[model samples]
Target: MPEPTYRQILYASRSEAGIDVDHILQQSRHNNAVDGITGLLWHDGDHFVQVIEGPESSIAATYARIAIDPRHHDVTILSDRPVGAREFGYWSMERAGKSMQDGAVMLARLERRLTNAPETVRQAFTAATKR
Candidate 1:
């Protein structure tokens, strides 16, 4: 069967701003073992966006590798759609670490997951993002 067309994927995670992404990307090299892996890494306020493209199998397989890799965790898919340009332009891992301002990303996600946060808190976050 022909491979599925590549899909655009945008994901984010929050971690310490000082975290070294260079190290993370290098670690993934041997672990993922998939060829043509290339991408860009960027961070803003602790939020990260990574664009990776290639064979669907490679993408899916690498995601598994990323999840298991100790370098990163709590990954979230913010947006995904078919885009004309492959932002990453390669199949390698682009580890975009966190920024200090967006440090709340993990806390916010955890709040939603545990269902311990109040409605007002969630609403405030939503309102803040819209602006």
Candidate 2:
């Protein structure tokens, strides 16, 4: 098969009313993924990790929409890795909502990352709504 062109877009949004994050991430019926596109979305209660790959135009357009999408909170492009392979092939969009803790089980990874993140990121995180 030919190599794939990957462009990642990460965004955050509060969990919709009556909708579980896992359900939104695991289902392949989403209009975006249903088309000839492949990607994954992950939510850690505060932010998200999104990986989308396809033709450049579609990805760009989609990214624009995602930025303004009301369903999502803080929509930002984490990385637009070109020609990168999909990491979550099993899921058109995999949503992992569990707050993970290290083996010590002392601190939440999300909180740790947020605290450690640069001042700019921390500010953005604070402004963004959590899922």
Candidate 3:
């Protein structure tokens, strides 16, 4: 059989001054599951960072929707590329809500399992998610 076509994308954006994390997660989980996407999201008071993985077409379509979302601005794609496997296979959309220090520790553990991700993407993940 041919290898599964998987792609991972990392992006950063400035969240609206008072965006609701719970609401975003709830919507994302539902939308992603319907599209067969899986990923993780991290948001601090000022910024948002997300990594999504799935088929190329679905990733593109989902990102197109995200790029136009009014809740965030100055969105920038940090990395986007094809991968050998899923880095976040289990979660439809896991939100990292711990303090920055604790979030960094959590990301460190997750980094080990994301061997297929580029070093730049991993570095951005750490920087974006940590204080």
C-alpha TM-scores of all predictions: 0.51, 0.53, 0.81
Clash counts for all predictions: 7, 3, 0
Clashing pairs in 3: none
Worst 10 residues of 2 by lDDT: 101-110
Considering summed lDDT, which 10 consecutive residues are worst modelled in model 3? Answer: 105-114
Q: After superposition, how far is residue 84 of candidate 2 from its true place, in Å?
A: 4.3
Query: Which regions of candidate 3 fall more than 4 Å away from where they truly are?
Result: 98-102, 109-127
Evaluate model 3: give its lDDT. 0.79
Top TM-score hit = 3
lDDT of 3 by residue, 1-131 (tens): 88897988878788888888889899999999998899888787777878889998899999999999999987878767787788778899988745755676556645554467677666665665563
In candidate 2 the C-alpha lDDT for residue 99 amounts to 56
Model 1 weakest 10-residue run by lDDT: 106-115
lDDT of 3 at 26: 95
**For residues 54-76, could you state the per-residue lDDT of candidate 2 as single tens digits?**
56776777667666755556465
Q: Rank the candidates by TM-score, best first.
A: 3, 2, 1
Candidate 2 Cα misplacement greater than 4 A, ranges: 1-4, 11-28, 99-131
CA error at residue 32 for candidate 1, angstroms? 7.5
